[model samples]
Target: MEEFTQQAGPFTDAQQWWIEKIADATAATETDFAPKLLEGFPFSARGGTFGFLHDFGREAAINLLDELRRALA
Candidate 1:
């Protein structure tokens, strides 16, 4: 998580907010963290094509962060 906050740069304001929120929720061990995260980005295929693409990009960012975390660990 620290790795994410540190190295995952060049993020938009909204993306940065989400990243910080995720880190905070994770550190606090928020039980509903996943749900809250999803709620924050309520974009889906059913919503619109662009939204789906945006969500896909967000997922990729998350996957990259996870990979980084695992590699560091």
Candidate 2:
């Protein structure tokens, strides 16, 4: 995740904000749950992927937050 943030740039304001939020949430999560929750999160913009929260857009990000909430529950 740090690699993606350091290497990727020029993201939309929304994308940037959500990515940081996601990173923060991930950091707050328990170590065991973090990996599973982020298992499919895109870490790079390779192979036509949008990378991280860029691919998630607003709705997906919201859904992911909900999932994270559920996991923490």
Candidate that scores best on lDDT: 2
Against the unseen true structure, what C-alpha lDDT does each candidate score?
A: 0.49, 0.50
Clashing pairs in model 2, backbone N/Cα/C closer than 3 A: none
- Give the Å error, residue 14, model 2: 0.3
Clashing pairs in 1: none
* Residues 1-73 of candidate 1: C-alpha lDDT, one tens digit per residue: 6555566566666556555554564556644344324434332313333432364486765574465445344
What would the TM-scores of all predictions be? 0.46, 0.38
* Weakest ten-residue segment in model 1 by summed lDDT: 43-52
Candidate 2 residue-wise lDDT, 1-73, digit = tens: 5456555555566566655655665656644234334444443322122444356665665665565455444
